[model samples]
Target: MTRPVRRTRRALQVAGAVGAALLALSACSSSSGSSGSGSSATSDSSKSSSPKVSGTVTVFAAASLKESFTSLGKEFEKQHPGTKATFNFGGSDTLAASITGGAPADVFAAASPKTMAIVTDKKDAATTPITFVRNQLEIATLPGNPDKVSSLKDLTKSGLKVVLCDKTVPCGAAAQKALDASHLRLTPVSYEQDVKSALTKVELKEADAAVVYRTDVKAAGDKVEGVEFPESAKAINDYPIALLKNAPNAAAAKAFIELVTSAEGQKVLSRAGFLKP
Candidate 1:
């Protein structure tokens, strides 16, 4: 009777131990499954928080867009976290040449379609270029109009000391076309490298008058006075924007383009005197 009682006691103890071991195994499996599910949820939440777009977007833009583009770039940064804009502002022709030469620019904004054509012609652009803005020429003169430059023809008057952009620049090319349409020939004292330089000459009173974009004159503010020329209508230039084919940050490039075409971007451009395209 004592032996039977001991065997019964041992059997109860073994059964209890086995039950405890099963419970421990079950708890561990449940904990592991819960941990895995929690990890997956965290990963999903991180991915949905924001589109991961980061890197520098280099842009080559025409000198005329300097102020407006600079402002737009700042606003773009606020909209896109971890993104930066780098601008190379200069004559449109020069900028186009740089893009074609593998300057690693993400986007090119040219003052004239002709300048953009140079890039598209070479197939250096990634997509079809779109017209973003239009600008017309204006006669920039000294604050008081001391030389009395009234029109395009007035530039031809002897001793007027006119200044014009070099033919390689967009403004210079448009000025030539306008002059040809008006059947007027004027010899400037100096051919400036860019519109800003030509305007600078007029601002400093170094030149009596210079043909520049209306936006440039607006940007100059009190530095110079702008005289509207009727012939400017015939020489209007359209600005185009496009992504470069070899852009290092293609995603950032496309995002920048979309921002420029947005309503906020247009307002900035309009404030700078650029006509909507």
Candidate 2:
């Protein structure tokens, strides 16, 4: 071949090699991009399916949460190996006070938003408090409802011994609102510090009846009878929960909160007689 012909053939060979190289690079890039996308999707799926959380999470919750929360704590521990859950249950206001007083708790679950407000107002909550459940008041009477207390007005019956939660607590506040709505005046034998205590009085026959939470009555089982009153609708308490600002186990606390708000958690609360928020 002549020199010109040989030069044209060499140019064509070089162009083909460059084109092959470019195509090879493009293929590699496409493969890399696809792999990265798949990896990211897998990572996200894994994260959502089995979140990684491990630590000791301390939760301060209302007295009514004692049973359901205790069960959730055990489930949390089981789901996250190397993690543990500890709970402090009491009156909502008292628990809020403890949290605001610098208690090293990871989470706070109150029976009423009013109680949770104390923490949020003090900037002790990591985020806005969210209502997880609601509760209504019920007249807890002796087994068989011996006194036949059917309504809030029945509690005002002459000479009937009754107990009530102190007005500061959520149950008490609800009870007072209910009574006020019914335009009824009830004179209780005594005022207990919490719903459980008030229910305990009736369970022990210390009083004929007590205005307490419906959940408390259910928890008391056959020991007490629950009398649903119409006025209770006007005084339902919204139970709020949140992670503390200074949580010692932030990750675990978040996980616990998620579990509590999950369908499974709601089921447990419903079984305990708590209404969903």
Best-fitting candidate, scored by lDDT: 1
lDDT of 1 by residue, 158-222 (tens): 88889999998999999999999999998899998889889999888898899999999999998
lDDT (10s digit) by residue, model 2, range 70-157: 9999999988989999998888889899888998999999988889999999999998898999998888888898788888898888
Q: Which residue runs of candidate 2 sit more than 4 Å off their true CA positions?
A: 1-51
RMSD of each: 6.9, 5.3
Query: For each candidate, what is the lDDT?
Result: 0.91, 0.91
Stretches > 4 Å off in candidate 1? 1-50
Which residue pairs clash in candidate 2? none
lDDT of 2: 0.91
